[model samples]
Target: MVVYAPAVLFFLAFCVGVLRDRRRFSNAVFLGLAAVFALAAWLVELIREDEQLGRSVVVGLLVLATLGIVVLAGFLVSNGVTMIRKEGRSPANLLSLLGGVALVGLLALLVAAWVLHTHTLLVVAGTAVALAGYVGFLFLCFISYAFLYGRLHIRRRADYVVVLGSGLVGGSSVPPLLASRLERARAVHARLSVRGRQPVLLTSGGQGPDEDLPEAHAMADYLVERGFPAELVEREDRSASTEENLRFSKSIMEKANPDYRCVIVTNNYHVFRAAMTSRQVGVRGHVVGSATASYFWPSAMIREFVAIFLAYRRTNLGICLALLLGGALIWWMR
Candidate 1:
């Protein structure tokens, strides 16, 4: 019972945070930690019951983990190729492909060091591997909790429906990705209408140098063309990035209705981060995501994660450095 206390307490804190507001990265981290400690507690109880069985289970888990990584690498490579053909040959599309190749290379290096029985090489590899593992763990935490966080439902009526913009298709058209978001916004608007709530549809984006017109104007036209009410649509065509999109939209929503509640719309891969950003910008909004193409999702998600990691680069770098140094010290001692 005492062993389970940490898990219970973390879970309790997570519940409190979520109940207070579900749009928190901390809440998801708390939930993930709770799950981790719960598993640790179960493993301890199992070990106490039977030492041999516990050891076997741990060994089996390591094997499974290796196999899982191999499988993931394969998937990433295949998906990356698909992105090249379907999405384009942009540098951004190569992230998954390069990541998969790097993983395979790392494994090969480890095998080479092991087969050669080189203590120095092994130590260096171990330190590098530890750092990679630390970053990978954070990535896992982000994606896993993002999956859980996206299950949030919009029970309360919204006064505004915000559709965040991606770049325009050419200079004057909505891209498939942006279209998906608008379609989802329309559905949300329909639901709010059914609840006797008339939420304003706000399209947020600014003109880019290559674009002929503002993205917000293009999105608003797309919605109207698709039978969304023109009267209910307002355009905030002054934002150049996600942060600007939310901040400027927040300004517009506040000006119109000082006590407004809103829901943001973006592609499925972008939802969690958008919600987090919305919260940061003091927007009272829960985000809902639209469908995204499978081939594009991994790279898009990786890009999002990189942005987040860089946003907290100091903290992330310090943790990775600590892990690397710790591994090196242990290796030196051995």
Candidate 2:
């Protein structure tokens, strides 16, 4: 209980920081500190305990932590190496370089400790610290989403509603998730229609390998079944990914109405990333989220964060490596 004081304090600080200014990167830093303190508290308890059961638990946790670090490090290395050797010194290459440097520095630290006759417990502790740093990074990725989502606002109405496609059921029917998005899009469309502003509905998705038809067609059909007019619906069936979906749909919208104001509709779990993709694809629009199931939110949010992290893989990896090096230096000094 005593070991948890710092963790509790850091957690409070994090909550306060977010409450004060939820959009800033500094909030992420505070949350990261809280995660580090929490991990440290757990590690300290493991170290202080004397019973066999306690020791076993500590060992198991340490092993799991080490494996997680190794796997993450491996992924960084492989991604970096691939970017360097094939893709050149783009952002991905930079990520690989930073990850490689961190791995080397960590390895050097271990060797130095080995040469200096440091206690085995100290080495284990260092590994735990490294793992904590990586976990903190993962925590930051999730925290960024919460921060972004909290700050987002639907500031204006639009002339068109674009519903981005998720997977289709049997490649011909709208799944519940996609249906929710279409429903939201329809509601928005209906609202605008009632105000004497009828917006075109763009259902965007292409055929994947498992699908028998394009996702856009399925979405269009679903919207029609829900009593949306067929003439008001447009299909973008050539897009194979989110980027393509937005880009292709934007092209379609631009051709019909060059000065188009649009809002993208996706599931609540996907709104942030979809907006980011919209920005990336040069779509001039905001995003609106439909409802998602409570049980699905955690995993779906995690997936969205990972997708965003990978989208800017180099910068994110560089930041993580910097944090890793800082943690390693602290471990060495101790």
Candidate 3:
């Protein structure tokens, strides 16, 4: 019961933090810490209840869970590696490298502690520290995502509107996610038109393996069917990714009119990351988010947070490495 006290306190604090400021990253940190503490307490209680079960079932379960985590981490690392191979050195590639190295090191440490005779306290403390490092990494991801989202600055009026490509459902039809983006762009266009300002709509996307036609073509058709002027709509059918979507659309806009201010539309979950990508690609525009289904927001936001963190790999990696090393040293000395 005494051992569980810290977990209870942390949880109470986390709840308070969440209620106070839902938008702050500190809320996530507090909740994550509370969860870890609770899990640790539960594991301890389980071990105490049945020593044999602890040695066999509990240990096995923990090992399996660890392996699953490693596998997922490996997938991310491999994806990063593939991106590097195809696109050359980038911030995302650096994140993969750092994450891969840290994961490998952690696994090696775990194996050493299990196989060799080491001070049990030292091993336990080291594991806790490593867990904390993982939490810090997650927190960094959230902060980066928020930073990008907050920095986006859209003008009151624009001469053109661009709906960025997410992907296609069946090569011709827009998925619910992509449709949300298109609808948001349409709303913005309508608002501008109501104020006597006309803006051209640019739908941007390109053909992929499963896509029967370019995403831009499908988007343009959706607009026209909904009574958008066909003459005012342009299809940028050569962009394969977000970077290409912004860059190619900018080119088309420039050709049509040299001075064009536009807003890029995407899902709310993706607004921040897209804005950062826009800046990196030299696209002069702001980003606006469309509404998303309630159930999809959490996971989608987590994905975007991860993407933004990877965009600033060096700083995040440096912080994580420092914390991990410091924690390991403290545990060893103690």
For model 2, the stretches where C-alpha displacement exceeds 4 angstroms are: 1-155, 323-334
Span of ten consecutive residues with least summed lDDT in model 3: 18-27
Clashes of 2: 1
Clashing pairs in 1: none
Write one digit per residue (lDDT tens) for candidate 1, span 157-186: 799999999998669988888889999999
lDDT score, residue 206, model 1?
Answer: 98
Clashing pairs in model 2?
A: 80-96
Candidate ranking under TM-score, highest first, comes to: 1, 2, 3
Instruction: State how far residue 65 of model 3 sits from its true place (Å).
Output: 24
Q: What digit string (tens of lDDT, one per residue) describes model 3 on residues 201-254?
A: 999999888999988999999889988889989899999888899989889988
Clashes of 1: 0
Query: Which regions in candidate 3 have their CA more than 4 angstroms from the true location?
Result: 1-154
lDDT of 2 by residue, 170-272 (tens): 7677888888999988887877677677788999999989999999999998878878899999899998888998999999989988889898888877776
- Estimate TM-scores for all models: 0.95, 0.61, 0.60
